[model samples]
Target chain A: MKLLLRLKFLGTDFCGWQYQPNARTVQGTLTAAAREVFGTDCRITGCSRTDSGVHANDFAATLELPFADCPIPCARIPAAFAMRLPPDVSVTAASPVADDFHPRYTVLTKEYVYQILVSPVPDPFLYGRVWHYPKKLLPDAAARMNAVAAELVGRQDFASFMAAGSKITDTVRTVSDCRVQREGDLIILTIAADGFLYNMVRIIAGTLLLAGAGKLDRVGMRRIIDAKDRAAAGATAPPEGLYLNRVTYHE
Target chain B: MKLLLRLKFLGTDFCGWQYQPNARTVQGTLTAAAREVFGTDCRITGCSRTDSGVHANDFAATLELPFADCPIPCARIPAAFAMRLPPDVSVTAASPVADDFHPRYTVLTKEYVYQILVSPVPDPFLYGRVWHYPKKLLPDAAARMNAVAAELVGRQDFASFMAAGSKITDTVRTVSDCRVQREGDLIILTIAADGFLYNMVRIIAGTLLLAGAGKLDRVGMRRIIDAKDRAAAGATAPPEGLYLNRVTYHE
Candidate 1:
């Protein structure tokens, strides 16, 4: 039977989501926990790969249980996994899925949020969760960022915003929604897309920050997209400010 | 010269606010950082004493510098202290203060907030920031808790809620406001008082938790206050869920 699990993690102590030799990764830790609960031969697959120090409010994964008569109940799976996982990682929910359902292959939109702190006073509580940019943005910068973000919607090639050093040739993807807003001391940038390229969200965040700072404008964003060159865009923002918010499945 | 600083700390790694021999305390760390910027002979006084693992959003402190010609400028004091302090502790603001000013004695009101997570699923991000109570509270429990908390307002001898082992004989204090509100998955208990006894807020939070669970009520709260015995109230809640929200003084 296939099991679907919803997970949340701080990601500060993790190398990334994928399993890597001689490194501490979220997948490696979850796999170890899964092995302890579902035996050593269990199969585990993560829906999305995140960079180091990137947090996730909601992440999905799939696990294949070999035993049909597993003693662990569906609702009790989270509790059982919680015992084996570290305090920084938590399995929030678990349920049985169809045999053909894949965590990644299910066509749906994925949401990501990037948080930036704009206060001169540093917050010790949000140390690793937000990018502390002490500089003040131009007045009405949030609206300008939102205006620029709206240009990315619809199916288009986003090669200029993609990070370099990727072997995949296709850079075309459908962006559903993009929003920029301010909440208290935080500037939140949320983007939803059918798919994302390597470091695409981070690059977009970096570019929006530039626009908010008045260094770039909406016309500049259009030019960058037309150029289709990675060098034409702003630098990639740090992973600590990024959070994988949600992943919706069609079925 | 005297200087005042607005401080913030996570308090997760500290023993408490007071300085102790061979122990990691917020006072000890702050003093060490103070000495680094204001010479070794400087004296530091904290506004309030917080228990171990209790966070602070806005704590005030007064520092007496022995040298009038200190190299660090007044505006640069926070930055200098920031360099010497850990990431978990920060000096948000620094300014000159009158020689007669005192952080504790000159205070008007102190506000504290206790957070309780009312969810079956645990939150990894708020693990150390809130009390995780998986049990469902009785309906209208927040209003009941508030009704009970209202009894704490006004001047009264709160010996029953105070923890034992303090040498101070006086237990009379004035509570200006006590509120209980729910925000999404968190039930926040905010209290503002002229003074607080040792472990007073924690005990109140504990008694309110009982009230929310239908084990106690407003009548029980009045009786607890009237008894004036240390053992009359509920158990002291854990320190991790408490936060010293603000310290306001009449200038």
Candidate 2:
């Protein structure tokens, strides 16, 4: 049997989802709990491998396993898993999935949100979870920065936006939708992408934010993207502001 | 000049607001930071002292200083002080206040909120910030609790609803307002009073929650309060759910 789980986490305390040799990873924790609950070990696949300090409201993962007796309750799994998992990582929702349903390959859309905590005095409660920028940026200015990011929508070569790593040979991806809006003191950057590269979402956020702060122009960002060189991009944004808000796998 | 500031804090990481002999209290942190900013020793009087693992969204405090200074930017005082403060504490606003004013005495009201995370599964990110209850309580229970707590409004003998060591010899207290409202997945128990004794509010919350869960009837709670015995009250709720949500100071 295969299982799919919807999860949320304040990723600051974990070293990302995928299993590592010795580090405490979200995948490792989840896999261990799953093995305990299911009474068997299985292969668990995640939709995205988020960086440390990055948050997620809806992260989807699938695990293929064989259990002894019966189906575990969806709500019960998160409770049981949470008891064994650390404080920062949690299995929020879980359910049995079809054998053919992949957590990533069959995803319909992926939504990511980046938060900008624009305030003179930093929010102490939000210190580790939000990116605090003391300088005030006009709402229109932020919209303009997001406009630069909007230009990169649709299928395009994202070589310039990719971080300094040749981990993936494919650098092309499509941004289905992108928008930047302000909710109170929070500048919310929501981007829906058919696919994303290594640090692609964060880099795009950084580039547009520079334009928003009047440090870079829209034309400059376009030129950098056209340059197709990793050096041509702006600095990568901090992982704290990034959130893998949702992962939509087709029904 | 005397400085009055509004602060917000997630108190889970610190001892209570007052400075303890060896523990890290919020007041100790503030005093340390104030010394660095004002370049002299100072006293900070918080309108309310929250316990460990408690949280505060609105609070007022006085930073006593002879800031008739020759140099540093006064407008940036809070930001500067914030840098030295811990991640859980924040100065939301700072302004010069009358030298004679006292935060505790001037406070008109204080509102404490208890957030019960009513769900089978606990939220990892909200650990230590919310109290999770595995059983799902019936809706409208909050309304019933609110109605029951209304009987305790005005001045009344709150001895039975207070902790064992409530030192304020007079057990009479006025509850301006008492509300139990369910917001999202949380059950918010808010109580406003002129003041409270140590653990008094927590004891009240625990008793009220018992009424909300149908464990205690209104008549039984009234009898308990009239009995004037601390043991008649329900157990003190965990500190995690309680928050010093607001403090109102007089002009």
Candidate 3:
């Protein structure tokens, strides 16, 4: 019996969310916890392989645990696993999913938020969680960027905004939503898509940031998108500022 | 001439806030940054020797620099220092105070907060920042804790709540305000006082936690306060959840 669990984590101390061999990964930790609790690690998979230093408010993973004749105290599993886990890792919830249910192959969109701290002083409290770009972004940059993002809301070739040598053949992912908002010292970049290519988000965010920072104007943005070449886009933004905000799935 | 600067830091990456004879302390980091910018080994002094894993929002500190011959770029000292310093430590503000202004002695009041996360599953993002007390608190614990905190307000002999083995002759400190508020799943305990003895805030927070958890009754709180004995108090809370929120100076 496999269980699909929703999770949230701070990925600073992790080597991203994947199960690297002999590495301290979020999935590896979860695997170990599951092994300890259920006494096996046959089936476990993550919804996404978040890059190093990335954060997540809602990440998911599937694990196979025999609910039939569970010998251990199943109710105390979360608390028990929590005791053995470090402060940086936490299990939000666990539930039994259909045997065919998959965390990654689910039919829905993923929402990510790229945080930028635009202020004279870097927020000490939000150091790692946000990109400390204290240099004031250009006025009307948010609106202009939103307009550019609107162009990407539908299915389109996102090859220009993806890292080179991406094995994924399809660059026609539908960007369901792309909105930018400013709150005090923060510039939040919310992007939703059916799927993402390698470094697609970081690259797209970089292009948008260039526009927001006034380095690349709206014309440049249009040129980059139409070029359909990875080299035409701006530098890839840092991974620390990116967050896996949520992953939606239908029943 | 010297320049005194008040600051704050997340102590997770630091050994502690004070400078040790041979250690990577917050003071050491600040002093190094100050030297890198001011070109002088400024003797930085912190208000408290915050324990390892402790956090401070407005940790008071004084930086002794040769302000007389300060470089033309000295006005950009905070930004320069921040760049040289690590992400966890920040020079929030820089101002020239009196030469005799000692961060520890000249401070009039300090406010601190201890957070508790009462939920079934821990929040991975708030792991290093908040204490996870997944145990269900008493139903009316919030209101009950507030009422008890109000009683402890004003000038009172806080000997009972203060941690043991202190040499301070006076244990009477005016607790201006102590509040318990819940925002989402996190519970924050905020306290302000003219001065605090060793582990005073932690001990008080621990006892209040007891009240919130229903481990100790309201009468027990008064008894502990009136007892005026350190042994009468609950366990001292962990350092991770405690934050030196701010420091106030006397006229």
Question: Count of backbone clashes for each model?
Answer: 0, 0, 0
- In the order shown, the candidates' DockQ scores are 0.62, 0.67, 0.60
- Which residue pairs in candidate 1 collide? none
Candidate 2 or 1, higher DockQ = 2
| Residue runs of model 2 more than 4 Å from their true location after superposition | A68-71, A216-221, B66-74
Going through the candidates in order, the fraction of native interface contacts each one reproduces equals 0.57, 0.68, 0.70
Off by over 4 Å in 1: A38-41, B38-41, B67-76
Candidate 3 chain A, run of 10 with poorest lDDT = A66-75
For TM-score, the strongest prediction is: 1
Q: Write down the TM-score of model 2's second chain.
A: 0.92
lDDT of 3 by residue, A1-251 (tens): 77667778888889998889977888888877877776666467889888889988988888777565445454666676787677677767667778888888884999999988876567667877888886767887777677666666788888898788878777878889998887877778999998888888888877888778667765777788889899999889888899998888878
Which pairs of residues clash in candidate 2, taking residues 3 or more apart in a chain or in different chains? none
Residue A148 in model 1: lDDT = 91
lDDT of 1 by residue, B1-251 (tens): 88888899998888878999999988899899887776676788999888899999999998888766556777777778767888788898888888899999999999999998887667889988888777789777787888888999999999998888887689999999999988888889999999899999999999998888888877888999999998889989899889999999878
Give me the runs in candidate 3 sitting further than 4 Å from their true place: A66-76, A119-124, A139-144, A217-219, B67-69, B72-75
Worst 10 residues of 2 chain A by lDDT: A66-75
Q: Worst ten-residue run, lDDT, model 1 chain B? A: B66-75
